[model samples]
Target: MKTLYIVRHAKSSWKYSGIEDIDRPLKKRGIKDAHLMSKFLSKEIARPDVFISSSANRALHTGIIFCENLEYPLANLQINRQLYSFSDGYLVKTVYALDDAFNSAIIFSHDHGINTFVNKFGNTPIAHVSTCGIIGIKFQEKHWKNIKKGKTFMVEFPKNHK
Candidate 1:
C-alpha cells in the first residue's frame, strides 16, 4: 500500500502585486496556520518517508514547516517544478514518477490541482482544499502507476483549528 498526502499551499501575501505568483510568500496567518497544521499532523498522521513540494516559495515554505514538526530533514525534500501547476495532469505525473523506494510521500501544491485531486481520487466529495488544507489517501496498490483510486484516510484544514 502507498500513502499520499496532498497539501495546499498556505495563504499568500498579495501585498506585492509586482511579484510573480510563484514568488509570493506566506501571509502572517499562513505562517501560523502552517505551524498548527504541521503540529497536528505530526501527532495524528504517520510520518511520510519523503516530502515532495513545488519549488514555489509558498509551497516550499509550507513543506518546510511540516518537516520541522515531523522531524524530517528539509534539505532532502524533492522539489518538483511541475507541482507549481493548476492542472491535475502534472500532479498525477509527478506522483506516478515517484521513487518506489518510498512508500509514503507528502506533496505540497496548489488548486485547482489539489481540489481536483482530492475529489477524483478520494472516496468522499471535497468542495475545495483551502489554504493549508491536507487530504490523505491510502492506495491499495503497491506501485504508484497502478493506482487508480484510494480510500480517504484523513482531511485537515486550518479552519478546523479555529
Candidate 2:
C-alpha cells in the first residue's frame, strides 16, 4: 500500500506588504500550529519516505518544521516549483510520477489544490482546509502509478481530531 500525506502550509503573515505572495513567511500562530501539528503527526503516523513541497516560502518552511519534528533528513526533501499552484490534475500527475521506492510520501503545499486533490481522491467534504492541516490518504496499490481517484481507504484531517 501507498500513503499520501497532504499537508497545507501554515498561515502566512501579511505584515510585510511589499513582499510577493510567494515569499510571505509564516505568522507566529502558524509557527505554533506547525509545531503542534508536527508533534501530532510524529506520534500518530509513520515517517514518510519522501517529502515533496512547493518552493514558496510558507510551504517550504512548513515542510521544514514537519521534517524537524519527524526526524526526516533535509536531503530527502524535494522542492518542486510546480507544486506552488498546482491544480488537481497536476497534483495527481505529480503523485503518479513519484519514485516507486517510496512507500509513503508527504506533499506540503497550499490549499484549493490540496483540498481538491483530497476531495477528489478521498471523499473529504471540507470547505477550507485549515492552516497546518493534514489529510492522510491510503491507496491500495503498491506503486504510485497504480493509484486512482476514489481509491482512498481513509482520510484524516487535523480539524477532525480537534
lDDT of each: 0.92, 0.84
Return the TM-score for candidate 2, rounded to 2 decimals: 0.91
True-structure RMSD, every candidate: 0.8, 1.9
Candidate 1's TM-score: 0.97
TM-scores, each model vs. reference: 0.97, 0.91
Candidate 1 clashes: the total is 0
- In model 1, the Cα lDDT at residue 158 comes to 91
lDDT tens digits by residue: candidate 2, 124-157: 5667678888888888887899887544444445
- List ranges where model 1 is wrong by over 4 Å: none
lDDT of model 2 at position 71: 97
